[model samples]
Target: MRTTHALVQLALALMSAPQERHWGYELSKTSGVRSGAMYPRLRQMLDEGWLVDGWETSEEAGGRPARRYYRLTEDGQRELGALLRRAESDSRFGGLDLRMA
Candidate 1:
């Protein structure tokens, strides 16, 4: 992984609840990333086998259509660890002190 800031942000967001499914909009909001960019990166992560996705349906959602939810795979957890380590050591994030939560 390239370890860009956005990537780090997304990884942190997903890793926060690795065992729970998350909506894209919620991820975007939590990560401070816009949906326009978040969705594309999410798709890429799915294709790279870092994330598993599924549609969630709920009648309580005001009859809204199902929303796609994503969670990290085991491989993704390992990848996230590596990515966080890299980000912590990278010059670009030197002042950020990135750490797994």
Candidate 2:
């Protein structure tokens, strides 16, 4: 699914960051995905055991309340590694000229 791919990209971005918690809006910005598409995928990832979500009460606002944060689960880390390896082996990406200037 396209959404799944986007979620994977989002997860990779989060993993690259030094911070532990990634809020919804931050993840959306980092992944180049809109909130509409990203949130449902995030919920699915949480249901699938690929991600863990929690609230940060200290950061709560008036009516909005706490923001939910997401982090990759152990299974998710392993899955990401496998997916990256597969992608690397695929000729579609392997043949690309990724050399930097």
Judging by TM-score against the true structure, name the best candidate.
1
Off by over 4 Å in 1: 60-62, 95-97
The clash count for each model shown is: 0, 0
Per-candidate Cα RMSD to the true structure, in Å, reads 1.7, 4.6
Error of 2 at 86 (Å): 2.3
In model 2, which regions exceed 4 Å deviation? 1-5, 59-64, 90-101
Scored by lDDT, model 2 comes in at 0.66
Per-residue lDDT of model 2, residues 1-101, tens digit only = 24255655565566665247788888888767788878887787778787788888764655676787888788766655565555555565554322211
Maximum-lDDT candidate: 1
Candidate 1 per-residue lDDT, tens place, 1-101, comes to 46677788898888888888989889998788888878888888898899999887686465788888898999888898788877877888776546667
The models' CA-based lDDT, in order, is: 0.83, 0.66
lDDT minimum window of 10 residues, candidate 2: 92-101
Give TM-scores for every candidate, taking all chains together and pairing residue i with residue i.
Answer: 0.88, 0.69
